[model samples]
Every structure is written in C-alpha cells, then in structure tokens.
Target: MNDTSEKSSPRPRATILGGGPAGLMAAERLARLADVHVFDSMPSFGRKFLLAGKSGLNITHGEQLEAFLARFGEARTLLEPALRAFPPNAIRDWAEALGIETFEGSSGRIFPVAMKASPLLRAWLARLRESGVSFHARHEWQGWTEDGALRFGTPDGEATFTADVTVLALGGASWPRLGADGSWTPFLSARGVETAPFRPANCGFDIQWSEHLLDRFAGSPLKSISLSFCGRTVKGDFVVTKTGIEGSAVYALSAALRDSLEAGANTVLMLDLAPDRTLSQLASALSAPRGKTSLANHLRKKAGIDGVKAALLREIAGKALLDDPAKLAHAIKNLPLRLDRPRPIAEAISVAGGIALSELDESFMLKKCAGVFAAGEMLDWEAPTGGYLLSACLATGRAAGEGAARWLRRS
Candidate 1:
C-alpha cells in the first residue's frame, strides 16, 4: 500500500582527466551512476595504447600472482591489493566482455587476438558512450583555477568545469608527443602533495662504444643473450644502438641502472655473450684453437661468438685478451660494459617517480585534496614491460572509479 516515487535530482558528475587506458577505465566504471566525462589533450584517446600495440598489445602476464606481484619492486606492497582484486584473469575477462578476444603468447604475455589496439579501442569507446559517458578531446588540462575548478585549454578558448569528483589518469613524461607530458606534477605539488621526480624507466642507457663498434654494430640485434646488473639477470635479445645497448633485456634492468645513475654511481651491465656455454667449457674450447686460423674465425667456429657478439667482446675485453684463452673465456662469460647515463625520458617506455604513494589513500584518492584520485603512470610506481604497467593502471583506475562513486554517494 506504499506508492512513493523518488524525487528527481541532478546526478553527481565525475570528471576523468586524460583519456588513456586509466581514464577510460575510470569513466567506464563511474558511468553506471554518475555523469561521467573523460577529457584528453590528444585529438582522440589511447594514442600510446595504440602505439604499444603496434608490435603487439601485451595486455597482461599469465604468470602466478606471486611472481607477477614481485615485478613491481618497492611498490609491490602498495599495489598488491588493487592487483589482487583485478588480476590478469580480470583483465582478460574485461577485454573479452568488450568483444576483444585475447591469448597468451609463448612468453606468457597476454595479447588481443587481433594484436592491434584500434579495434579494441573503438569497441571500448562505443561501450563507454552507451554507458552514458562523455568525451572531450584536445582539452588540455592546465591545472586548476584559483577557485579549485578544473581548467583546460581548448581549441576554441580556455574552459573550466567543476565536478563532484575527479580522477587524474594523466600518464608520465614518456612519449610526450602522445600527450602524457607530466605537466600535472606541479599542480599536486603546489597543494602540498608529495611527488617523486619523474625519471626514465624501461629505457636505454648510453655507453662508451668505440667509433668502430658503433659504426658496425649500431643497428645489429644481439639475440639470445643474458644481461645482469644489480643482482638481477634477464635473458632476452637487445639491440646495439649507436649510443648503447637497449631492448627487452636492457629494459628489464633499466630501473636499477637509472637509479644508479641518479645516485651518482658508476653502473655496469654484464653481458654473457654465450650464455649457453659455461666459462670452463669456453676456456677448454678456446685452448684447442687452430694453429693459423684468424682470431675472429677461430672464435666464430669454436664458441659461436662472431658478428655483433664478437665485436662487443672485443670492445670490452680488448684484442690482447683474445690471445689469452683463460682471460678471454672469463671475459666472454662476464663482459662488463659500463653505462654512462640513461636515455632521455622522452625515449623511455614508461617512467618511474610520480605522485608518491604516501599522498594517496588506499582508495587512490589524494588525502590532502579530497575527491581527487589518481591512477596510471602519474603514480609513483614502475614495472618492466610484459604487461605489468597496464595491469596496474587498469586496477588502480577501477579502484579510483569505485571510490569516486562511493565518495559521491556519501556526499
């Protein structure tokens, strides 16, 4: 016998700045109840995501939680809760719901079946639109106004807006051309929110390569090699760039190397030219060298070290050691190449050092600035490639979205 209709009222507005994966995910979650709006500096959204998928869209890793969690390093503890709640399985499921089928590669890195981000992004945008979410492109966030309103510079002119809650998914300082330029750092810092200086991550380091080696092997790939630094070893292929070495293996240890350089310490990357052969085995093989064969030929035939690998060894161990089998074998097994400095942040894949974790609550909302949440590379956490970065971004975005909804409901 109770017939009562709820009073009509304006829905709470949730604004998500930066239309990357993190911002998009937050908008998706918040659109259920709030008037969600996603703003981006780019012409459209997900430019970096598309670029990442140019090779293949490594969505997430299919490894066990323990191993996958360990990849976050010092931020592992801070990120475990978000990741555990929405782990690899959750990511695959979310993609599937968007009609984007994904599969695990041989390396256990997950990717969409199409292996491109365009289809997935198109489908995602459609879904967000259907969910009552709005998009504003080329509206570059220019920090906040004196009255605490979100300010953006648009093609037409400067615009301002106020939202019940805001989720900042502005990415780090990598790929500035793609829109994540780390311009939001000062905004939070000015509000007494602590932040770490953005630094390169998963990037190349400069080395003193002789002009000869640089010219010959600058673009060559050093395949099936092992690189170790700071007690961490990664077995993968890397390319010899004109400045230094870079690729999967080098990037895996980029954080440690970049940190070392920041601390003003000399850093060395040890490359095992022939990882398959033991040091003793290499010595024994070299000891039985030909009587008149050329040193390069002898190396290629006996130890399978030639081309760029041989050049790298000579670059580090010198030609005199090539005559000494024992020393040459040791050098081949542990060729130490000192790294000068990390490539500029513009060239990094992602970046470390952002809004410090201490500044945000467990829900990813800034404690000092209530109703303001942050996610993605804007936060001070870095993980190597192979999908760790994207997973954390998605998880934290979801957390912020759910938190924003709750905060708005309470208000």
Candidate 2:
C-alpha cells in the first residue's frame, strides 16, 4: 500500500472519489480536521452541476420538513436522519456562509440570486482551497489493488494511494458525457456491496404520434394542463417532442409510468387538456349551433381550445368524435395517450437506482468495508425534480463526511 500520510502532520489522510456536490461537500466537512484530497475523472469539477444550473440553480426547496422528507418516497426512512441533520435551511445557511445569496421562487424552489451554479461553485472551491483541501482532476478511480490499496488510472498511467479513510460520491448512471456513467458498479459488486439495477427517472416516454401531428406540433408546448397516471395527477406544462412528451409535468409522473412499463403493464398517460373548464360547462358551450364557422374556429370560439391543443384533440380523437358535443367534452376531460417506453437513461434528467441502503450503516459507512463510506446519487433513492434530488445528495454527502470524521477520530 502506498503511504500517502504526511509524517509531519497529525491529521489523518482522507481521500474522496468524485468531485461532485456530494464529494465536494464531504471534502469541505473534513477540510480542517483531516488532510483531504478530492479526485475526479472529468477535466473539471461539477460539470453536471453546471449544466443543471445553466437555466437556474435550484439549490433546495422551501417546503415544510415533513413534506420535503416525504418527497423521497420509499427511501425516506433510510435518508431521514441525514436529511434532518442537514436540512434545506442548513443548506441555505451554508451557501450564505460562502457569500452566495439565495431566493425562493413562487413554486417554493430556492435558487441562488446569481441564477447560475458557476458563482456558487467558484466560491466553494475557493473556500475549500483556503482550508487546504487538495484537488486532482482527470484521476478515475479503478477500484482497489490486490493489496487493498486505492487504485486510480491517471493521465500519466496507473497509480495507487492509501488513506486512513475514503468516501465514494460517484453519481448514478445518467448523462455519461458529464462523467457519471455508473462504471463503479462492478468494483463495489466485487466487494459484495449490494446495488440495484439503474432505471431512467425524471425522463420522457416515447409515443407513436401520427406523422401529421409531428409535422404540425412536434415542438409545441402544452401549457396549463394536468397529467394523470395511476391515482395521482399534477398540474404543469410539457413539451411535445418529435418522439414523445417531456417537461415538468411529464417528469413528475415518470416514476410510476416507468415502473408500469417495466412490469409489462400497458401504460397510458391521461391528459386533461382543459383543466380549468368543467365538463358540463364545456358540453353546454359546444352545444351551440354553428352553421359555417368551421370546426377549428367553432371549437376555438366555444371551448377556448386552439393551436397545439386543437391539433392534439383532432389527432387523438377523430373528426367523428368532434361532431358529438358530449363525447368531445368527455374526451377533452380525459384524453388517453399510450406511452411506448421511457427514453434512454443518458437522456434522462436523473436515474432511479444505485447502491442499496441496506449495505450501509447509520453513519453512511459500508457495513462490510471499514473506513469506507458512500453518498449522493450513487445510493438507491429517487426523487422528482424541483430541488428534491439535489437536496438529498447534499444531505447524504454531509452525513458521509461526518461519519468519516468520526471514524478518523476513533483510529
């Protein structure tokens, strides 16, 4: 094993793999107490984080603690302690300490005032550097050597390093171009670490749209609509893509839809095209006589449905249904469109599965592997967009760091 420990220093050596939000946060936690080293395969740190914040960096949500914790679904029990330890408010406070001001959107999502991740990341890196944390880019972890030392494949060739403690914050399988490709699975598996097969989450599904619909409204937006699947419904907007639909609303219900398809059940996404108008009101409006107003104009004037909405209605329900007022009103209320399959994981916003929680203890340390801990999207948990994903990752990273610190103290 390579002796990376500094004989001149009293602090123990701590090595963190993956320079994402989770890994960086871990380094920050151990910066002053331990000799910290962070490594990433990518040329720079936070590539995926920067991409996500290109539009707006949603730092966390401003919801109640119970509601926020419930967003994690089944993994809530396992993640509760970490989340409660470092909640959303704590994250805001941490950012403020780094000199980044944040504001809450109308939707209760918190974002940095600068509206981009670069400023926050730059400030964070500066703080880490000031605290004496070392960073190394282009160093991809290649599991362990036969002697159990940490092995990494660097640009210069293979290298080995030993540390008193290690933390793995490698992300789940999504956006391979951004460096999180789930390539660490086999390495952990070889050590008897349990993991769940990854699935596409917060993703769009394919739909066999008619060529006419694609030609006219492929890239159009469906605003002020509600999408329902199973027993749940959400109100938001989604874009009609060349292959299928995607956006906030579609991503909200993607988990259920993906599971149904995986179970070999035929999945259909129900759309309420006109959610604000009542069925009776729409029926009464369509009952009016129209001599030569034209079907499109008549529907538009009567039901306030035009553009892509009108195109979708005609495409799904044939012209025969359009002639019937009651049938047309009902169809508008409950339009059923079949979903073929989910988009590829690379195209998804995030992934669903990773290292199973049962493999780790309360301190986020592996039960079988002493002095090694794991955190971030590499864990077996999934949440929708709207800040839930990032929040849990940051929380888990903090927990892992604290856990590793405790281990170092004991040693």
Candidate 3:
C-alpha cells in the first residue's frame, strides 16, 4: 500500500499596481501580513515624487487640521476620515521614524532636512525591502485578462498576476512622463467603475498677451502681488509664461479659473500691481506734475510700477488709460486680465477628476470591484501643492492598504 501526502497551500499575495508614494505606502502596510508586490510602468518607482522634490521635498503642511482640510475644497468631506486618521503631524512623525527628520518652512510646509526626496525614499525603500515588500518596475498594467487576472505588459511580453487583494494607485493623468498616464481609466470603466473625466487642477491659464508684451515680459515674475478671482484673493509670486501665467499664485486660483472657463464663463482676474499703494494715494501721486517725463517713467517714479508690472498695465488697460490720472489709478487698483483657457492637463501639477468618490466606500475599496482598492490621485480628489497633495495621497494609501488587509482576512 502506498501513502499519499497533502500539498501545502500557497501564501496570500497582495499586489499594488503603481509605484508612486501611494502604492509604495500601501505595500509597506501589507508587507508583514502578505506577499506584497508593487508594480509600475516606469523604470523605477517615485519618479514624479523625485521630480517634485527636486527643488525641495514638501512632505506635508504644518498648519492645523481645519485649515489643512479646507485646502481640499469640495473633496474635504470625502477625504476627511482618511486624512484625520493620518494627519500632517502623523506624516512628520512617520518621516522622523524613517530617520528623515523634518522641519517646517516659513510657510508652514514640512520638508526633510536633506531637502530632497532621494534620502527619504532610499530609507523608506530599505525598510520595505527588509520587511520583504518586492517591487517590479516597467510592468505597465493593461487592465484584466479574459480570466479576470490582472494583466500587465512587461518587457518580455504580457504577464498576469492573481492576488488575494489589489490596490490601484495608478495616479492621475498629470506628468505622464513620470508614469501616471491614466491608461487604466477605460479598463475600469468597462468593468462598471463610475469615473469622472479628468480635468486640469493646478495648471496655468492662457492669456491673449500682445506680441510686444510676450517678447519682453514673458518669464518675468510678478512679485509680492495679490491676485483676486471668484471672491478669493491670493498674494504670492507668479511667472508670466510665453502662453500665459503660472506659479504659486495662479495655481492657488487655478481650480476656480479652470471650472469657470469650462462653464463657458468669461474669467477676468484682478491684479493689484501696487498692493502697498491705495487708490487715493496712487491718484494723488499720478496727478503730480511729470515735468516732460514719459508716462511710463512718471508711473514708475510715483507708483513703483515698472518692468513686467508696467507692461501688464499697458497691455490690459491700454495706453489711453494712463493719460487720465484717475483712470490710471483705478486701473492700477484693479487691472482686469482676461483668461482665455486653461493649459492642457498633461502640463498640470495635478488633475481634479478621476474615480468618483461615490465609486468607493469609506475604506477606499471600489464598490463595483470587491477586493480592489484605490488611492492617491487616482481617486476623485484634488489639492493644491505645498504638501497637501502628498499628504492626502499617503493618508488614502494607508487607508486602502488597511482595507485590503481586512478584506483579505474576510475572504
């Protein structure tokens, strides 16, 4: 008589289909409990993240939670739970725990002391590797196979991965060169995942600048100026691009401006060329005798408006307005610059629309597709730069990873 032995069961595998901060965080969270793997389309993980930190890695904001949550605008309520679970303070603690100590900047933005992403990423990756989380780069996800297995286009050929749980942090369509091309939208949509069309969020707007102004003023910075639109005012510096305007100030108001343009509304932005000067003060100063001096020279001497600011006044309000002191003062107080359109989503810092919040539960697990979770920019939420974007991504990533782990236990 021959004896037969029973075969051992295979270990539960958890796959993350993106290697951005969101995917990496999720993998880290699940590494100890399951066979965790992260896959990406790029040659390496966190390319966009590294690019963001090229200047300085803004890890999170140091502001209070109420003010921080307001940065998310309409998505605030939807993202509230995850963000509460892992707020900015928690982000700082996490970074410090990874041996990358953080410090708050003048604007309350938190950054690693090294001021770059590489050190932090390297430390985080080492921790993940030690914990047994694996990464597979250049494996572009191509949706699902006929048998419902997760399919990807590898260098050799198409490959499939079946897992007990899946997390899709494929990011939004912004910065496609960094690997978030948004090719997964159609795949999920076909499978009954309700998604919103992606639109540019923190992107620049196109202005019909005269060739003369474009030739001389393009790339010039509007320093310490205040921009007002839709009843909100943001004071910062923005650069005058060849096509239009961009920078921290413009990006702050971009969501409103983009939405207004999309609704076929004429968007006019009011710029205070001389924030320090009042209308009456400017009028009195302009009314003073020029003594045969050029109007540009007079304006510069009296109002401290010259260079790009002077050119912008003449470009939008015309030279005729300068002749009348009252009109000139009024125009200086409120220079109306009409925005024609928003720059393409590809050039945006981040996009607004994606998988709708309705498509996912509080746990960030896709309702239409069980055992599958989504995080980061892939979800339908948008925030401005200055660390709000990365904070939300990490928060949601942790929530999704925990959700996946819970779902795996139940299944």
TM-score of each: 0.95, 0.97, 0.95
Tens digit of per-residue lDDT, candidate 3, span 182-225:
89999999889988999998899999788999899899999988
Clashes of each: 0, 0, 0
Provide the lDDT at 392 for model 3.
94
Ranking of all candidate structures by their lDDT, best first: 2, 1, 3
Please state the error at residue 183 of candidate 2 in Å. 0.2
Clashing pairs in 1: none
| Candidate 2 RMSD to the correct structure | 1.6
Q: What overall lDDT goes with each candidate model? A: 0.90, 0.92, 0.90
lDDT of 3 at 18: 94
| Candidate 3 or 2, higher TM-score | 2
The candidate that wins on lDDT is: 2
List the candidate 2 regions with Cα displacement exceeding 4 Å: 1-8
lDDT (10s digit) by residue, model 2, range 1-411: 333433456779899999999999999888878989998999999888898889698889999999999999999988999999999999999999999999999999999998999988999999999999999898889999888788888778887877889999999989999999999999999999999999999999999999999999999999999999999999999999999999999999999999999999989999999899999999999989989899899888999899999988998887889999999999888999899999999999899889999999999999989999999999999999988888988999999999999999998
Candidate 1 deviates by what RMSD? 4.9
